[model samples]
Target: GARHGINMNGKLQRLQEQEERIFSSSCENLVEQIIEKKKKKKRKTIETDE
Candidate 1:
């Protein structure tokens, strides 16, 4: 019973790590998009002020 429990724990840990990696990569793309949107907004405001 202890051996089976350890095996399940390892599998769960690996799955968690994989999910984290996927989330982090997707998060980077989201951050980049947000930055781009902010830059665009700033440019528009500058143009309007001019």
Candidate 2:
């Protein structure tokens, strides 16, 4: 029973780590998208100014 408990804990820890990695990567992607949108907006403004 103790061994089973240890195994379960290990599995849970691995799952948490995987989730964190996925979350961080998704956050980075979101930031990149926002930056791209901002760049596009700036380009549009510049073109309008000229």
* TM-score of candidate 2 relative to the true fold: 0.94
- Which tens-of-lDDT digit does each residue in 24-44 have in candidate 2? 999999999999999999999
TM-scores for every predicted model:
0.67, 0.94
CA displacement after TM-score superposition, residue 45 of candidate 1 (Å): 5.3
- Look at candidate 2 and tell me the lDDT of residue 4: 100
lDDT of 1 by residue, 20-50 (tens): 9999999999999999999999999999999
In model 1, which range of ten residues has the least summed lDDT?
A: 20-29
Model 1 scores a TM of 0.67
